[model samples]
Target: ASQQFKENLTLVATHEKKLELKRSACPKPGPGQALVHVRATGVCGSDVHFWQHAGLGPWKITDCTALGHESGGEVVAVGEGVTNVSVGDRVAIEPGVPCGKATCNFCLTGQYNLCPTVDFYSVPPKDGTLTRYHVHPAGWLHKVPKSMKWAEIALLEPLSVCLSATLRAELKLGQPVLITGAGPIGVVQLLCAKASGCSPIVITDLSSERLDFAKKLVPSVNTYQVDTKKDAKTAAREIVDVFTNAADMGVQVMPEVTMECTGVESSIHTAAYATQSAGLVFIVGVGKDFIQVPFMELSVRQITVSHLFRYSNTWPRAIRLVAGGVIDLLPIVTKTFPLEQADEAVRHSADRTKFSVKTLIVDGEE
Candidate 1:
């Protein structure tokens, strides 16, 4: 097959106002690669950030770039040396492709999320899967069950992120947990934690609408609506007191594990203060390069802090968990649009008042 496919809609950056949809040709797969018929591509927060800010952390956008990474599709063609999947097989593409060389410590340990040679899709100069068709390495594709919905399958990438963070926290069964930020990633973390056997999960967010949506997915969860402009430490103390039953135990706070999902600096500090002594604080949110952390308090409390990037060695487990009904991802997708309306979908994702948790661009729908 030739790479001269039709011009499809793609979000491009030019250090200007925002991402603009441009017409582009379908890219061909190289060795060990497969051409995927894009079915559903998710609009992530990072995608919005890249569109507005033109970069994330140290990664900058110097050229026109397609911005989407959470996606799923069917295999339309395979390059030479590809053996895992054939044409017509439904698969979820892991957007990050790392150099699988043995010399790389991250690859050797199967923790390729840390691999420096990783080429992540949707970042600068890397065309994402938002177009009609995309080509990716077969090694990064995971076959989806026929019974799974494309929208749910598209979520495997973000779920892998939550799984990685939860794994780093080393959560135990029946342990109380608190998650800051009730956004898509935060809700996904709640689901992953529940699947991992954590109990009494509590989540905090600024919007009551998001908290309401979260309640529908996790009915038994304890949620608190926070004022983003207020002092997070005071709010965190109040929440911790309520969870710890300070009225009975006289303890200041509780929760064995705290998963900070909001990249906001205040939320990070709040999570640190809210965590129990000798507990773990997993920073799942991607914040600025540096922030003032309460190291002295953490030292006295013996709190362990861990950070997360995208994900690695987690897709198989996440797939199995979602397949086994341990985690229901259907609720995460709040809206869907056709590929022609790709720009609208991205705009909806950028506006939180639209009550959009996850917006997927559907290329083909009956």
Candidate 2:
């Protein structure tokens, strides 16, 4: 292991969403670690968020750091005791590395995503997978078929998220479901729900273009163009009339579960109104520190609300679903760029005037 292996080209995020490509010293794999030759990485909303704020929540990007989590790569080298993956293994990178201590109850209970000390990539200050070479715990890398394209494999991370939300929300066969927001997460949720045999799947978005994109991706998913000008109560009535509600006043039907992908307060309120009594409203979107909620209404109906921090034990299922042909995410990918153009790729993905579902940065053949 020479100290002069090679300098890695890394994408670093700074204040005010500025991104710079810099040469970083590539380090050797330590015990139980794998030095990955990153093939592709997806730019996520959170990536843009971190770039804009120089950090997220309480974590500030003082020193700056690379920011990516959705990643797929090839193992170029493995360290001692790394048995599951070896050199040349193509894999998806699970960015959250929990402090695998047995003393932690969350890890023991298979909810490692909740581990207090989990080090998630791109969460400000932590070097992420947005580089040509990255060293990650071997256990966090899941082997994928070589047949899977690099971007497709990288998408397994977000797919894992939607799958986790689906499982927790109890989406099942022939159940009506409502999803708020038509962003990439919403589209992926639609796919996961459609595969779960959810009946009359529905999605809403403020932008008609995004809603249309969701329907194009999944023809069965019904779409609603949200009127942002309308108040939450009026929006709720419209949504209810469109998705559920029978002719009889006494026999009104509503979605059994609601996926609130937009953290907008009004959208959350609409979700509360559109769901059936005793139903669950699952939130996966990051919003303000505190937004007003319709607690009285939810309390009266006994509707339970929950949230997703990240995902755990979902990569294997995500792999099985995509690899076994349950769903194809290639369409959701709007574009790809070579690693050299990562800055441009991220900017394009974040541009509102420009339309893009997902943009990927891939390591081109040297």
- The TM-score obtained by model 1 is 0.93
Candidate 2 matches the true fold with a TM-score of 0.95
Q: Each candidate's TM vs. the true structure?
A: 0.93, 0.95
Q: Please write out the lDDT profile of model 1 over residues 1-366, one tens digit for every residue.
A: 433356656666556747677876766789999989888888899888887888877778887678789898889889899999988898998999889998999989988988998989987667777877788989999998887788878889889999888888988888889999999999999888787787678889888998898888888788878876767678877777667662245654488899999988888888888888899889988777789888897899999998888888888888888888888998888888998888788889998567888888888862
lDDT of 2 by residue, 275-324 (tens): 88999999988789989899999999999999998799999899889988
The local distance difference test score of each candidate is 0.84, 0.88
| lDDT at residue 142 of model 1 (Cα atoms) | 95
Q: In model 1, where do residues sit more than 4 Å from their true spots?
A: 1-7, 228-230, 245-253
Best-performing candidate as measured by TM-score = 2
Kindly give the number of clashing pairs for every candidate.
0, 0
| Lowest lDDT 10-residue stretch of candidate 1 | 244-253
RMSD of each: 2.5, 2.5
What residue pairs clash in candidate 1, if any at all? Answer: none
